[model samples]
Target: MNRDKVTEDRKKLGDFGEEMAKKYLINKGYTICHEKFRCPRGEIDLIAKNQDDLVFIEVKTRRSLRFGEPFESVDIRKQKKMIKLAQYYMNYYKISQVNVRFDVVSVLLDESWDVKEIKLIENAFY
Candidate 1:
């Protein structure tokens, strides 16, 4: 495939993965608050209400795990950015005294781009 096609396909895969992640969370009783929440600080994949707590999620998806598990990609730098974004989100919404948490939803896909696995890591980071 050409570079442009590759990029487009990759984006499509990401969109599909995000949609799947949102549906999975909803099925688990989470109320979707935002998808692709972005600002100058950073981008949040998904933000939702998991019962009483506000949940900030990072959804990572891969068709192959030759590098490592999908969640393993959320390195320290990314975590820090996400943290900052989460704080910004809270402040922007004037959310106070509400429990908040970070989560990682790893999505594994097959060669055909069909979801093969979905793993939710709750309380993934402080």
Candidate 2:
């Protein structure tokens, strides 16, 4: 109800959604490299590898889409920050000769913490 409580609730919901997303990716044959990878610029929700390709995924979770879809929350500035963080991660890991892509996972949750919808957008941005 209060602002802090609302923020905490949203954070919890987002964490839950990220866990579900990680499991979903694993089921789809993606090896999760990291969760909440952070750099000075920004943070990436999930970094995964499918074969030789590295995937940078942004997970957006919401209770409902009354205002807009979860994926719509990722704006251009966020994308640029994520890209910068991904580049930093790549350099830090010394990973070369691997394909890279950006993806978005939109998660919709119900009151009972049940996932109502999970939309996976592959190659969502540059």
Candidate 3:
């Protein structure tokens, strides 16, 4: 496949994973606040509310584990970026004094694009 096609496919997969993550969170009692929150710096996959805490979430999806588990991709650098983006989001919305949490949702899909497993890691970072 060409680069464009590959990029498009990846984007589609990401969107699928995010939708699944949202549903999972909703079932677990999280309120969806935003999706694909972006700024001049970067984008956050999802922002949600879990009772008293504002949760910033990163969804990572993969069809296979050749590279590693999806959550493994969120390295320290990525964590820092998420933190900055979360701060930006809060400032943009004038949100303060609420408990904050960082979370990672890992979605693994089978060859047919069916979800194989979904894992939620709360407080994945500071």
lDDT ranking from best candidate downward: 3, 1, 2
Q: Each candidate's lDDT (Cα)? A: 0.93, 0.91, 0.97
Q: What TM-score does each of the candidates earn?
A: 0.94, 0.93, 0.98
**Candidate 3, 62: how far from true, in Å?**
0.3
lDDT, candidate 3, at 23: 100
Global CA lDDT of candidate 1, please?
Answer: 0.93
Error of 3 at 21 (Å): 0.5
Pairs with backbone N, CA or C atoms under 3 Å apart (clashes), candidate 3: none
lDDT of 1 by residue, 2-44 (tens): 9999999888888898999999999999999999999998789
* Cα lDDT for residue 115, candidate 3: 95
Write candidate 3's Cα lDDT for 8-78 as tens digits. 99999999999999999999999999999989989999999999999999999999999999999999999
Cα lDDT, model 1, residue 120: 96
**In model 2, what is the error at residue 25, expressed in angstroms?**
1.0
Query: Which has the better TM-score: candidate 1, or candidate 2?
Result: 1
Stronger candidate by lDDT (1 vs 2) = 1
Candidate 2: 10-residue stretch with minimal lDDT: 61-70
Candidate 3: misplaced stretches above 4 Å?
Answer: none
TM-score of 1: 0.94
